[model samples]
Target: MRNSRIPFVKYLIELLIVAFGVFLGIMISTYQNNNRTEKNIKKSIGFIHRELKSNSQKLDKAIAYHYKLKSSFDSIKKELPSDLAMENYYTQQAFRHNKVPHWTGLGMASMDNIAFESAKISGIFQEMDIEEVQAISRAYSYFDSYTKFSENLMEKLLAIDSNSKVADIIVIFEVLGSDIIITEQRVKEEIDKINSQLENINK
Candidate 1:
């Protein structure tokens, strides 16, 4: 008896063709999406790099300003012992360059984490290695801590009264003087580390 059915080989070939077409479509789609992601990563990195660089510059200025304040306070401390006779003069000098405003601005200033944050929000950070995410988080954590310090310093500054004792003012200055030096050193180190990581990512 003659078979009416199509050969099994013919069906196999047809099914393979369909499978290949589907696989090819998927490959093309994946390639395009990967390319898009790469572009986005590069663009975001560029923006982050620029913002970080700017922040570094601002920090440098802030460090200098704080250092100057430290020097001023040192001078004031020297004269404090005998300055009772020179009360008005020393008091005026002590209050001369109130660092509160600048420090407040520095504390309140925003760091550019837009790229990092957006990446997290969009789940791109999940694609990053755990170490990379950790490094970024650690860097930002330092900044957050610094912000809190600034807030505390601002409160201290606000609490200063014209009638406040010179000894009290001196104490605040000494604390700030030491704190800022430590902060400046740490900031420089962190910036260098973060910039190195960013450059690696850019490459």
Candidate 2:
């Protein structure tokens, strides 16, 4: 038979105290972690929504240019022997007068959206919103098509030769006008979706 220095009652009490301490510490740590995660998610959503706003404005400007070109095309169709003046007007209208894309704003916007999405996905996964996703994903494609239309329009303008055909002018009006409408609709839908998600996050 072996005898311990401590009493059995005292040993049992000490073990219980240690287990309680460990459990309390765990509860505190877990609560803190949950709070921090919630804050981060909210922050991400806010940042991304701001980015989406800026990007939408830039795209909207492009859409305005498209509308202007369509108008120019309409009025000029009355005249014949399309010349330098008319072509130049159309080119300037089409390229937005050489207005460049807002890269800095766009970069910030992309980063914000990505961060927001990451934080969001980490928590309860919202059902995949692929419809809006598809529209949003098409931004670059819209730009690419419109850019080509712009360049080609510019070329036709430069080569006016004072004897341009009606067909040449009509081509630009057809392509650019149509593309702008599609892109504008897509951008609006994407903006609405982003706004809705951000509101949910904030609430």
For 1-203, candidate 1 gives per-residue lDDT tens digits of 13535566678889999999999999999999989887776766666667667666766766777676677667655655555533442356544435433343323334556766777787766665687667767776777777777787778766766665555555566766787668755875796688689878888
- Over 4 Å off, model 2: 1-6, 78-173
State TM-scores per candidate: 0.77, 0.56
Cα distance off (Å), candidate 2, residue 27:
1.2
| Model number with the top lDDT | 1
lDDT by residue for model 2 (153-194), tens:
567656754465445545555565576457565755666565
What are the clashing pairs of model 1?
A: none
Alpha-carbon lDDT, every model = 0.66, 0.53
In terms of TM-score, which candidate is strongest? 1
Task: Enumerate residue pairs that collide in model 2.
Answer: none
